[model samples]
Target: MAKDNDPRLLRGAAVRQRILDEAAQYIASQSSIGKLVSISIGEVAEVAVYVRNQARVAHQLKLPFDQEFWGSDVTQEECKARLQEMNDDPSILGVILQRPVPDHINLRSLQSAIHPLKDVEGMNPASIGNIIYNDVALAPCTAAAAVELIRETGLNMEGLEVVMVGHSEIVGKPVAMMLMAEGATVTVCHHMTRSVAMHSRRADVVVVAVGKAHLLGPDMIKPGAVVIDIGINQTPDGILGDVDTEAVKEVAGWITPVPGGVGPVTVAILMRNATIAHQRQIASGWLT
Candidate 1:
């Protein structure tokens, strides 16, 4: 297996650090600004990991980051009320509602409650809707990361044949829309697709986000095609991605590894989104 050290991966890390450094300097220059608050319901191990990583990045950036953990019994309305309060708070520049919230909570309702300006996670309908007009500056982190990795290939986006596996609103659908906005020819495959390999093998690029582990083997990919795997599945062997990395690496021109690939870039994009949200708040006269 030929493991490629994608220059884009290193470039993303460099960009992430640069943004944090710039943000730290900006915060130092400003009197009162640059605070990110994340709200979570219940004790989810995955959410804890995400929150910890975000907190670490925030500290490195010299931006104040806080997390609010609510009991599983917290009602949807209660969460919405809290979000509304944060929305009105001028001290808060960005707000993130962690996923896998309690089943009692209506995620969509609470997401909508978050003011679009403070919705740093970009899960709000308004943020996703903005992509329809090609306003992708505030797109979902994971989806944006996938597209960025594809761009790293240095291939012309216009008429690029891309087959995206999975059709979830957060990742699949938005990635497809964003790719289309870039003038790519996108074919999205989901559970009902007759033959995913048939479509995938014909594409110039393939992005897989289905949670199933090692679903895309080398045979499914076109030789020299760029592969971006967005899946993170825990296996007996450890963390795994949707694509079979060892096998696909030998055939694909470039590919993203599970833990080291999209994950870091996604976090970087989140920081970028936070910075952008802060800029939007400034534009709206919410912050001076």
Candidate 2:
């Protein structure tokens, strides 16, 4: 990884800013009935920051910006109420749900309550189907961002062996499907996988998403392989990822850093999804 800022990051930021600007224009031109409504700011401050940044990014791109952010408390009734508000508002272009809600809160209830069009995060079934079928639709932001980061590597994924070290529906499974869709051979391993290093060492590309910190060491990776670490583990020292970054960096030709790597891009991709959702809402003209 380059210690200095990458010029490519600037280019990506410019491209995404343009998309947000153009998307706002499209939304503004729609009839008045399509005014955007309720944007829920979940407990995840990271997500809230992303949403606010997207709004700011849109303004910087010279687009009309007007959005109301609503934060919902963590409670069964509160979640249901928030969903109701989201569903009731035709102008709400997108909704973001902070992850890891308390045990008392029901995720399924909130997920089901969200209208498919406003499910910008693409956790919704429709979005999943779009991903499965390779349709041009909004997808889970983090997964999409990870795939984009992979593409930026300039590695040819076609026929390459890729190993995804997580099995969650959120990232691992979906990313595996995306890789397979691109004609790459994909393997998914989790806690149950026997000898994960055997799978990882052989892969041309390795994506580690399990929450474990620095589980994969330099010896577990092949020389010149690409490594993508998706886990964000907070320890006393700070944050860590699944791949042993320091050790792997010497062996792997390209590796993404924990904080500045996938995390920032993941938020940027979510902005992309919100823009798409806004455009779709304007096109439907249902709320107007």
Candidate 3:
């Protein structure tokens, strides 16, 4: 464990603030009737609030978000229609579809309905294709954040053994692809993985996102390895990640805590995507 004022922490905090500030300016100047559409209004509100707060934090250096999007009866088609309608409007710059959609709707169609330029969530096939082909299109926010966390540690990822625990398209799979692209040997394990701790102990980097509480203890991690806990489980303790922070902190060289860790970086990166979307729209003469 290092001091709170570690230079890497400061650098990441600075980058997070800078993006939030730019995003806030874009959100304020651009929030108007033309940009409003009718998708899962509640989900849109939830995600928009997140974007705005991150933007606000960029200016104030700290802001708290306490909204939840649970139990919303928002359909994928409704979300798609809203995004399509907004994208049709030249004034609208970007859009994000909050995930964990119910099983009743086709996620593929909903994701495809989003314009590539406005697909800030980056889950659409085109966005996935961009990541697959290394085309530089929108990458998943959490995936980008996970990579950024590792990069800020000043460790070389080349040929490092990387094990990701979780198989979701949004976080785990994309991150595995990214690590592989960065020259690290990557392995993905999910809820069905047998002996997952064995894998974590052998890897140079262990990323846990299984949404379980305290699945990885201190003994599971390898010494001097970087651990990024991507899980967000709401337990009796409120919010908890898959990794046992107290146990792992003592054994691992680097680790990210749940609430103040990956969550903040995820929101910050989303704001970056929004800012880039806004700038792209402006450059393409869509916002004029």
lDDT of each: 0.85, 0.71, 0.70
lDDT of 2 at 17: 45
**On residues 37-139, what C-alpha lDDT tens digit does candidate 2 reach at each position?**
3244345566556557656654554433455443445577766686777666765556666565556667766776778787867787667777779763687
For residues 180-279, what per-residue lDDT tens digits would candidate 1 score against the true structure? Answer: 9999999999999999999999999999999999999999999989999999999998999899988888788888887777778788778878888888
TM-score of 1: 0.93
lDDT for model 3, please: 0.70
Residues 221-240 of candidate 3 have per-residue lDDT tens digits of 99878888888898988888
- TM-scores, all candidates, are 0.93, 0.80, 0.78
Full candidate order by lDDT, most accurate first: 1, 2, 3
How many clashes in candidate 1? 0
* lDDT of candidate 2 at residue 264, scale 0 to 100: 63
lDDT of 1 at 124: 91
